[model samples]
Target chain A: MGELEKIREARKKWQEKYEKSCTERDALFQSISGVPVKPLYTPEDAEGLDYLRDLGLPGEYPFTRGVRQNMYRGRLWTMRLFSGLGTAMDSNRRYHFLLDHGTTGLSVAFHMPTIMGVDSDNPRARGEVGRCGVAIDSLEDMEVLFDGIPLEKVSTSMTINAPAAILLALYIGVAEKQGVGPDKITGTIQNDILKEYIAQKSWIFPPEPSMRIITDILAFCSEHVPRWNTISISGYHIREAGSTAAQELAFTLADGLAYVEAGVKAGLDVDAFAPRLSFFFDAHLDFFEEIAKFRAARRIWAREMKERFKAKKTESLLLRFHTQTAGCSLTAQQPENNIVRTAFEALSGVLGGTQSLHTNSMDETLALPSEKAAQIALRTQQIIAFESGAADTIDPLAGSYYVESLTDRLEKQAYEYFERIEKLGGVVKAIERGFFQKEISDAAYRYQKEIEQKKRIIVGVNDYVVENEKVEIPVLVIDPEVERIQVARVKALREKRDNDAVKRRLEELKKAAAGSENLMAPILEASRAYATLGEIVDVLKSVFGEFKEIPVF
Target chain B: MERKVRVLVGKPGLDGHDRGAKVVASALRDAGMEVIYTGLHQTPEMIVEAAVQEDVDVVGLSILSGAHMALFPRVLELLKEKGVDDVLVTGGGIIPESDMEKLGKLGVGKLFGPGAPTGEIADYIREWFKSSSRAKG
Candidate 1:
């Protein structure tokens, strides 16, 4: 008999003997995303996987292994912890602390007022100023945010959308003040507006204008800020919003394709902007499945870019991503248990060949990470990078039969989703028709039911049976004084700055926004005049109306 | 026939973490209650007005932005000012146990935290509805 047939016969004989001798657990064996998990995988499972065709060498065409040739052997993945809270000064102190503790990059989280494009003094901003993140209303806040930290040295990732342009302009303005030009600054903006409409629900304008703004950013960044990652097409929020792994993979790639199409239609070269594009994904539970999802993501993206968009540059075809341990996986019952969950998820990201990572703190489910908890989270990554030996090799899980099989399955599932989305017109139309929203809601509800029905086990919740558990971890508390201080600072800036210059710049911005002009220049001009985020957003909102979602449950 | 338990699920403030809210809403619907979901970005005034207009017996406010302390009291005060005393205000988010107790002391119903079972929320509402004067009437 042939080797393959011999293995298949042996596997069948073993399964029959095993089944007769020992009964398996009386439960459905499946992945977190509902994919069936078989007992044993062998060479038969990887029957037709063409290693050379499907997964070439690291950094080669169809980069299913790793994006870089040497991978972490050349340089370790960046430990960029997402941190921001209270005022700019407060967050700045935390940044210095992180830097002192060996953090490689900076990630900023803006408060809701700043994120929603509202000034601290706006009535809508009441009770929310500096609550979730640092409140930056003008260039002044940005400057203070990077007070002693040099912009040229550390690459910053700002978690802001809808008002992403204004925030980017403010960062540029600050860089100029530090005598650093746009070319000298390097970082990424989560300028992914599509996911905002789909999951995050923090959208400012409708789809048409939002895409326009994104394309403008793409165009300008390709010319001026070549080192900057113009857009981090994100699947983090989609997964966080209760999407299945396949849905997150499919929808995120779909969004990336839509952005590529938008850029091409805007008359920009795909190779120019596509190379600068990046991705963000959530490293959730389901250890091997998460690894498979990452591997599949790279292969699918490279194939799509090469075949569909005709991307010529090798860089344009490469899929570089930042992974964050899933925040939704954290539990509040026994908070310390979250540390272990985050560590495992972080390990998955490492083995999946992530370029950057952010491990969630143990106290995050209750509040913003306290100082001690943030340190522990950072230490978790350090341990993985140095101690766990995960980063010692590239794509270490590449040829495993189960992993290879799962990767193929996920890639097939993602392509199927892409076809369904195409049939429904496109991503924006699908979003408008509530297709993505309904699918995610159903998945989320199903997962919840699984937990309630004892089908899935989440330790410390629903199963471990810890009654009268007292959470002893210290949670971060945002002082009420921070809001007062932020509101007063924005008010004082309004009084101190040149109001006429601000008005003139805003009017110029409105005119540029009305015309088909690249908005970065005018927005930077407004930022130079210390225009508040609310003012800049108001001007854009006048030209481009706000988006109201068709609420779906 | 007994009147269906009417619940107005309100997402107040600016944060967009609505997975919990939507799950609870669907669970309530599955539990055979009348659920009116006021989508995203509803202020306190808007939520109260919807409750009064819909004549909802319970108003469940989901605030994850840490603005619950400021928002919950505002909704309760507005409901009282509008002379809607029969309505119950309860919801869940990333609220701490201490804060939940404080809100409870402020006359709000029992608040839940993360990882809470939807069935428990439904049971809480049903039990409250049974004891509430609306059920006796």
Candidate 2:
């Protein structure tokens, strides 16, 4: 027999033993996402695999390895701790602290009221101002958010979906104040509204108008900023909302495809803004599966952007993403164990070659992270980059027989998801018909059942028993005075601003919103005119009114 | 025979994140409770109006954007003024326990933390209703 045949025979012999042994040990026979674990992978599993066509080199086409050459070796992945809860000034201080502690970027979290486009003093926004995230009632709050931080230096990511364009305009207005033109600023707004209808549910207007707003932002960003990411298409919230890995990949990429179509319909070229269109994914506790999902996402996006979307540039194909450790995996019982879970998830993000990463604080399962807990989260990333030696190589797990097979399988599964969504008439249509909602509901039900039945064990929750151990972690409490001070400030600002100018700007804003003009420019103008968020939203509401989601199930 | 407890799950204010509200609603329904979801973007007045109109035994408000401090008190106040003081008011979200305690003092029945099981929430509602019925009797 030939040398190759002899080696193949030996591998097959080992595989037979492995399959027999798998019958003995049931643990290796299953995966978290419910995919069955096979005994062995071979050249047969990777049949018809063209390395150049499928797995190209780092920084090349089909960027499944890494988006850039010398990814972390060039410079470590941006450590963006998702911070922003309470007043804008409070969040701004946290931003400076993160940047000072070697963070490469900023991720803004908005409060619920702000997310809904309500002003701080609005009866609706009363207690919510600066609660879950930084409150931005007007341009003043935006200016306070980026106080000393130069907009030209570090990248900032805002996690605002429904009011994304308004917030983006506020961000641009803030940058312009610093004498930096649109071309000099680089960052992303989580402006994905389709996913809002699918999973997150932070939607404002109806689907038709919401898509128009997204396209308007895409068009504006493509023409002006050029470097700023118009939309960070997100799957993080979807997974956190109870989607399995395949659902996350499929639903997220479907949303991406919908955005591309919307941009194209908006008279924008595919290559113009495709490079700046980024993604945000969740790094769950399932190690290899998460890594495989990331790899599959890159490969699928690259292939679709090239062949399907007819993109010419390699940058147009790469899916540069920011990953946050799964908050759902953390437990309030033994909060300390969350640190370990976050570390593993962060490691998975690094291995998956995330362009940037956010290691969730251990206290996240409870409240917003205290400064001390936030520091430990940052240190987790630092240890991975500086100490663990995991960042030393590009795509360290690239050639693993199991990993490659899993990546291929996940890619195939995601394609199946795409087909199913397409059959249901694309993402928006599917969401309207409650397709994605039903899938996620079923997945969540199954996962919850698994936990209840002890089939899937969460340490400290379902399996490991810790009795009456008092946690001594110092929890940060936002002073109740924050609400009192915020109310007073808004009251003062309302008293100071010109009522006539505010009314006039709002009228113009309503008129613009009523027509086909981009509401973002008006929102910015209104903000400059010292318009409060509620005032701007109230104007739009006068025209567009409030969105009422008809719950399907 | 006792009537099945009916609870209304509502998202008040502008916060649009409804995954938690939907999940809790489903869990409540699964636990043999009649759930009237008020959909999204409900104002405090609208929620109270719905609670009275729907004639629910309980009103459960879910908000993840941390607006419960202001919004919860308003909802509770509206319920009292509307002469629906017997209608149990509960909250579920990322509320700090201390705030929950403060809210409790203001007559917010209970606060369910993250990962709280559906059965526990259902049981709490049942017990509250049972006690209310006994007092009325």
Candidate 3:
């Protein structure tokens, strides 16, 4: 008999025997995304295997297996623990400490006030200044935040959304002050405003203007900051908001497609800005499933960029991504167990060939990670990079029948979602109708229900109950003094800065906002004048108006 | 006709972490209560104004930015000044034990922590409602 016929006969015989002999926990089994999981997989599971077309070589067309040809052998993935807390000066200390501890890249975590586009002294910003991250009020604080750090050397990623333009201006302003050219500075801005409306809820401007701002940044960054990644289209927050892996993949890629479409409509070449496009995914505890999701993400992005968007450049076709260990998966009870959970998640990111990664600290479920927990989180990445031989090979699980099946299935589901979204008139319209939000919320409710009923085990949470579990881990406390110090500094900045220059720049910004002109240059000019983040944001808000969310549930 | 239990879920201050708050709001809505969620970056005053306008029987403030010390007391004070004393002011989010005690002393209701179940939160609000003046005929 032919090999194919023999395999078919064996599979049929096995199925017949397994139907009667197989003992199972329940009737059905599936991954977190509800893709069915099989007991044992043979050649039948990996039915359609066109080696080159399905998953090209690591760096070849489609770039499915890995982004680069050499992968980790070329260089280890950047270990960037998203660290920032207290004042700019305080966070600067933490940055230096992290750098000294061998973090490959720097990621600034803006305080809640800063992220919301509010000054430290704003009444709404009271008590929140520098609580969650560094308080960046103006260019002065930005300079202090990067005091000794050279912008030309280290690749920094800023986790900012709604006011991404303002933050980018600040970064460029600081780089200029350091005598570094725009081309010399390399980094990424999480300029994904779509997810804000969909999940995170940190949105400022309404959607149309927000897309306008994104396209404007894309244009400006393409021309000026050639080396900078204009946007990090993020699924991290989507998954954190409780999206299924497929939903996270689909929604995020859909957002990327929408952004590319907007840029094209804005009269920019797709290849020019597409090469700078990057993705951010969440590495959850579903180890192999997360790996499959990552692989699927690469294949999908490569095919869609080359096919749908017709992106010509091979660089534009490459799907580079950063993975962050899931924060939502962290539990407060027996928080120490979070360390192990994070290590596993980080391994998934590394094995899945992430370009950069952020491993969450154990105590993050309670507060911002303490210094020790932050180090452990950083060490988690380092150990994966050096000790664990997981990264020694590219796409280690490439040929696994189960993994390939999961990847193929996830790819199919993602396409199905793309069709559904297209039917809804694209992402923005879908978002307006709360389609993405509804999907995430439904998934979230199901996941929560599963845990509540013990259908899912969350270690210390749903199963292996630990009563009176003392959380002895050290928690980082943002001192009341941090707020006091930050408030006074901003109040003083308002007094010392060139008020007339700030006013003129802000007025110019308002004019630019009112018009169809790109606002990046005007905002950069405002940053040069040392206008506070709140001032620039308010000037734009005066014209663009704030977004009021249509609650999904 | 029975009056529905009205809850205003407020995210006071600048914290944008509202996953827990949204989950709880959904839970309350699922539990047959009227839930009005004050979206992110709400000032304590704004939350109180929302509470007064919405005529909510309960105000659940969610603050994760470690600003509860300044925000919670302000919300409580604003509720009192608005002569809305009968309304319950409770909250959760990274609030250490000591602050929860202080907040409790300041007349805030039960403060749920990280692992606190949504069902228990719903029950607490329901129990408070049963004994509340609104529940009395």
Candidate 4:
């Protein structure tokens, strides 16, 4: 009490001095989620917050500090650079480069042709082969994608959701070629299709079928690929789609909770599969706000996993996430300024103790990052980890009056969102009724209005007087011939494979998809038989049918 | 007769990121146009056929997969082959400058880069049709 009184007196003295200087400064100092700022925190702030219950020791229950006890001290977070562009071989070269340059893991990004379940030669897949990311038309392209990379030793993350089961099957098939059984491989698939519907909108089938496909992967992976994360419930794209940090946190956790309920409903034990359930958060430009968001996300997810779902294992309560710098924050105008923006975002992720980080290139808002830009982006992380002293401490701002208060506030606000969502009949109903969509739309509209009104000043965009700063960095340009080369490769591979065998596999896939049988096995067999993405998707499309977007506005 | 300017907005290939396509659909609809957003993952054949079946005057393809170089020309070639010449074709997403130029040459009416205002795009569509109409008359 004496120590608390002394601290309170000191805080009161400073607050009185500061309050005299600026009348509204105290209130204005609050975090962006509209949480209030407090002058000082005593034990009173953490009242009833049992150490074991609220902020458990790292690697223990609740996992408030982190998933691992030693954290980065045990092993540095995976420095995975999410990159893929221009043909499989080209992306393969980049993968080798990233690994050579000390990337701990590989996160493969696919081109649209591959993402949409189309082969390169498909008329719709034209011009797009190997553009944004690597194009994997069949198991052949997947093989080229991992040409020399060891499947057994190195972990891989594929950012494919709509075709996640298909892609996972392809990767496992690739591993099989490398003589590594599915059990030996370690990686994650961004198989969180619900977020795809609510935010990213890259969904293949309707929600029911999509959830079924995801559960099938979860069921299969739990039995076989125990080390692999079946689904990386992502808030990255949600934030990029114009959600506030609080919305990202709430929506992502809600999606995760929904997934747990889905797994449980699908006749799987929560502890068995919940251990592999991971999260992906977006590290936006708001430094302290982003950090608060991450901390709050961890606390909320832990509480929900334990209290709501009654998850027993410590792993079930832990929210291990990978952070990607916000691509939406980068501006095409004065694009070079994006470097600083990305640096701040990366620092936020680091300070928040992310398990893995991917920083965006300055030129990303312009086109896919060129080699020089990608290198610069990677070097940003390197400089932050090595040169910057930020990483020396875990949760560096843990006890900050502002950060802790905001973390608590964000956790509270997210619960409010969960309650509101529950009232609106949970995430699925909210999505169907366009509640989440409308809320995000309103938030996006508000943010845009603020920017336009100069209420929110983006340095080069508004307030800062950079008139005509020429972007000097070399933008990576993919050769037009890459498309020709990719198309030819798909054509050649299709011709070389056993046509009848492929057809049989495709028919089996259609049959399995049409029926109640798990689609993953047949899809894997199809991939093994050299079935193209278009061929496989066509089978599903014929059976499950295409998704027709309903106008919500 | 005032023919409705029906636009088919599509995201082709495997990239399921459709924020742009959805936003543009909303904007176009707000601008007094009928927008058919053929959700994520449409094939070129599928998109072209939708355009024809819906009798859309514009087919806007929003591709974030960077597969435009491979897929855009094929869509255009398919549209031309299907004898759908009067359709105002456009594409958007993360397109490099060189690729944008190449796509324009291939009869993609416009390439809308990031941060290009929706109002500006709507205006461009209006102006393009006006000039074309004038030239024909």
Off by over 4 Å in 1: none
Q: What would the TM-scores of all predictions be?
A: 0.99, 0.93, 0.97, 0.87
lDDT string, candidate 4, A165-261, tens digits: 9899999999999999999999999999888778877767778888888889999999988999999999998888878888999999999999999
Q: What's the TM-score of chain B for every model shown?
A: 0.98, 0.94, 0.96, 0.92
Better of 1 and 2 by DockQ: 1
Candidate 4 local lDDT, B57-123, one digit each (tens): 7788887766677678878889899977887888688877777888888778888977666777788
Which candidate number maximizes TM-score?
Answer: 1
Instruction: Please give the range of 10 consecutive residues that has the lowest summed lDDT in model 3 chain A.
Output: A26-35
i-RMSD of all predictions? 0.8, 1.9, 1.6, 2.8
Q: Is candidate 3 or candidate 4 better by TM-score?
A: 3
Error at A191, model 2, angstroms: 0.9
Model 1 scores a TM of 0.99
Q: In candidate 1, what are the lDDT values of residues A1-553, reduced to their tens digit?
A: 9999999999999999988998888775988888889999999988999999999999998999999999999999999999999999999999999999999999999999888888988878778888889999999999999999999999999999899988989898889889999999999999999998889889889999999999999999999999999999999999999999999999999999999999999999999999999999999999999999999999999999999999999999999999999999999989999999999999999999999999999999899998899999999999999999998989999899999998999999999999999999999999999999999999999989998998999998988868999889887889989989988998999999999999999999999999999999999999899889999999999999999877778
DockQ of 3: 0.64
Docking class of 2: medium
Per-residue lDDT of model 3, residues A1-553, tens digit only: 9887799999889988999998777533767766677788877778888889998899998677999999999999998989889999899999999999999899999988889898888888777878888999999999999999988899999999999999999999999999999989999999999998888878888999999999999999999999999999999999998889999998999999899999999999999999999999999988999998999999888888888889999999888999999998898888999999999999999889899999999999788888899999998888888898887889899889888888888888899999999999999899889898888888887777677666767788867878877778888888889888988998898899889999999999999889988889999999999999999988888888988776545
Name the lDDT value of residue B107 in candidate 3.
Answer: 92
Candidate 2 stretches greater than 4 Å from native: A1-29, A39-44, A498-504, A518-520, B126-137
Docking quality tier of candidate 3? medium
DockQ of each: 0.82, 0.54, 0.64, 0.40
Compute the lDDT for candidate 1: 0.93
Model 2 lDDT tens row, A1-553: 9755776888888988877775553343567677887767766566656788878899987888988988998988888888897888899899999898989889998887788777776666666667678778888888999999998998899998778877887888899999999888988899998888877887767888788878888878888888899999999988988888888998899899899988888788999879889999999988999999999999999999998999887789989998999987888878998999999999999999998999989888667899989999999999999999999989998878788888988898899989998998888788878899888877777777677667777788767768765667877766667767777777888899887888888888888877898766777777777787767766666766555667743
